[model samples]
Target: MTSEFAVELRDVVKRFVTPEGNEIAAVDHVTMQIKNGEFFSMLGSSGCGKTTSLRMIAGFEWTTEGEVYIEGNPMGHTPPFQRKVNTVFQSYALFQHMTVFQNIAFGLEMEGAKEDEIKQRVGRALEMVQLTGMERRKPKQLSGGQQQRVAVARALVKTPDVLLLDEPLGALDLKLRKEMQLELKALQQQLGITFIYVTHDQEEALTMSDRIAVMSNGRVQQIGTPVEIYERPSNKFVADFIGESNFLDGQIKSLSKDEAQVFIPALNTELRGIPISQGLVKGEDVVVSIRPEKIRITEKNAKNDNFFKAKVTNTVYIGADTHVYTESQGVKIKVLEQNHISRLDTSSFYTVGQEVGLVLMPENTLVLKKV
Candidate 1:
């Protein structure tokens, strides 16, 4: 019988022995369920177990504990070729000496498929990636993007149930990488296949993934949609990693069903915020997180709840937005404001040492556990 999940890792762990003969858990008890036809991403920096988890799913490495299930079946000792999945790596892994057609057809040829069937499948796969006419060219003749597409086509020609991509766009320039991110998302949607992507770039994961698993220190920190992960991080690590957040060390002064009052010692005020982390209690130490863009700054002297008097310390303009650095009661905070209005004069911008009011809305403020 078919399952709703395309892949599942049940408390998976992968341990490696260091050259000094010390054992370390590269993947520490990671558990996740990837739905069929979903674009799931494992995002983290290097040595965070994101790549090791992907390799485990791809059969390059086996779990030291727990099990890996693919399509409701346990994949114990299943070889890469036997599993109904394919992977495209950062290097593209295209054969240098072969034409695009030959490289794409190599997998099918190994499966001992008839020549006509191989050609038909290869043509369809190439068309899927918009590389139909480039089959006769060598890998060297194609541009970086084109070669990447050829690599994708080779993987797609096999028609696996799931596709694994390990930083496939890492080699491309920024502009091309941005372009390919959209293309890959569109292709995944069009094909309606499960895609398990691994990348360290936060923006890339946010742009392309339907859901993301944020990993760090051999453990999965949080898994949710891009908006959820960015807007409501589970802990300090997630808040600081996924995006820029101004964190205030605080203690819970009072608690309600959905909101909490946090007393920040640095600011000497109690700020109200929605408590997102589980098991929060009254008088518990917590961290108040607010995104740089969420804090509103105005020149008007508005005294209200959660409002602070801040002085501008620095200002930076980067075409689309201006980053304003400020200090309130000795606490450093950064604010990002968009250039919504076109202006030629610098008079409207905040000046250094200018006093301003910062409004931190309770809805936009997040209270996380102090991990």
Candidate 2:
């Protein structure tokens, strides 16, 4: 996560002619830098051009405008095989007839490495991915997770300068996917290699990436570490896209460097928020976003700021935590609390039709200009 960028895109854009003969913009003038040895990820919904942007980096797709660079070298016109990178696709794309060893060895073989060198490299890679003894088995004989590991082994066997993974865990089941996410993070740290991962799963992105670029409408909306992105989203799109949020449409009543007061006309309350950027003025439409976990439900109104009262509408318990839905000033709000030893006061447990007070943690609330 240093200042030295491993990959840089300068106003890169990609477009394709749809069947209706209209040109569609997929990657729209995106400019970003992936730091050296950083686990950078591009995350977005389907059709947002995250995959298209990765393809351009992989040399599978060409950019209609701008330039793409890897380690300060221009990558335009370079073939995928000739680039200093390797890719692990969602399907693994392993040769069905090839044994694990063979699949891992293929890359080095194609690179013209000597026989002994290929054997040693492939064996070491198999062990690195924890698939040493499974090398003799074919892809079809292994479990989905095992085959996925083999695919990782094949990619690492090449020892490319950078690894591009396009939804590599998309096909795995939930439990397997979660396990692989941790494995991938550990492997990345152990190898100290640059990984450009592409995915739409916000949880996966937040879990594994050193930094994430949230994309929408083929444009990068925000780029930051998980904490920064979650707590200080740049705009409404990013605030809504990353996690569960309770948005209150309001008008900017006052502004300052650290905080602002938003007037919620419907609630007739001045909601305090931490402003993300400047230029907001009085009378300008704005929106304040507060995460569900930031809201606290209480039986009595405590002496504190950022407080409101709501009526309990629903309560959902998901083992370790509880989600309480309530309405305040005709605006719905959600609060999430862990069922831990300290916070459990079940005597005051909220029930439908019961009134409860809520306090939005001002430090956790984000202020965004209306879109």
Candidate 3:
């Protein structure tokens, strides 16, 4: 029977020995399930094991311990070509000498497919990537984006049950990369095939992934949709890694089922927030986290709960949003305000040293367990 999951890693661990004779686990007992036809991403910085995990799934690297399963069958020492998966690498790995059609048809030709079948599959793959007419072009003759499409086309020509991408768009320019992100997402949805993407760019993962597994120190820190990962990070690492977070050291003064009152030592006040981490107890040290955009800055002194008087330390206008840095009770905070009103003068902008009222909404405030 076909499994609901396209891939599964059960307590998988990949260990490596450094030149210094020290053993390290590149993937440390990490477990994840990529649903069938899901656009799943493994996201992290360098040396965080995201790439190593992908290599294991692609059969390029075997797990040092545990098992990697594809469609519920254990893939123990399985060769890359024998697996029902295809990998598109960052370098595109295209044949510089071969034409696009021949490059894409390389795999089918190796499989001993009839000449007619090879042509048909290659044509369909190129058409899928919107590069039908460019089949005569060589990899060196195409633009970066076009070359990337050719790589994708080559991978798609095999019609693998699952597609593995390791930073496939990392070689493109910023503008082109952003454009391809949307295109890749759309293609995945249209094809309805499982896409397992590995990337270090947080924004890229957020832009294209249906679900993301945030990895750190060879472990999966959190797995959730972009909304859940950004809005409610599971821990301090996830909160800080996924996006910008202003953290304050605090101790839990009171706890409820969903809410908690944390006493910030820096501010000398209690702030109410949702406890995102489990197993919280009273008097436990916690980190209070809030996104810059979630903070509200008011020019008027609004006397309300969780309101604090702050002085603007710096202001940066970055086109769509203005980042205002403030200091309150020795704690620095950043607030992101959108430029909703068009203005030609500096009068509308907040100047450094200007006093402002900062409000922290309980719903947006997150209390995370200090690691």
Query: Which candidate number has the best lDDT?
Result: 1
lDDT of 1 by residue, 1-371 (tens): 29989999999999999999999999999999999999999999999999999989999999999899999899988998899889998899899999999999998998999999999999999988888888889999999999999999999888889999999999999999999999999999999989999999999999999999999999999999999999988889999999899999999998888778889899888896565556999999888999999999975499778988899999999989999999998899999999998746899689999999998988989988887
lDDT of 2 by residue, 147-246 (tens): 8999898998888778899999999999999999999999999998899999989999999999999999899999999998998899989888999899
For candidate 3, the 10 contiguous residues with the lowest summed lDDT are 269-278
**RMSD for each of the candidates:** 1.3, 2.2, 1.3
TM-score of 2: 0.94
Candidate 1, residue 113: lDDT = 93
> Who is ahead in lDDT, 1 or 3?
1
In candidate 3, what are the lDDT values of residues 72-159, reduced to their tens digit? 9999999998999999988999999899999999989988999999999999999888998998888999999999999999998898
Q: lDDT per prediction?
A: 0.92, 0.87, 0.92
Which residue pairs of candidate 1 clash?
none
* C-alpha RMSD in Å of predicted model 3 compared with the true structure: 1.3
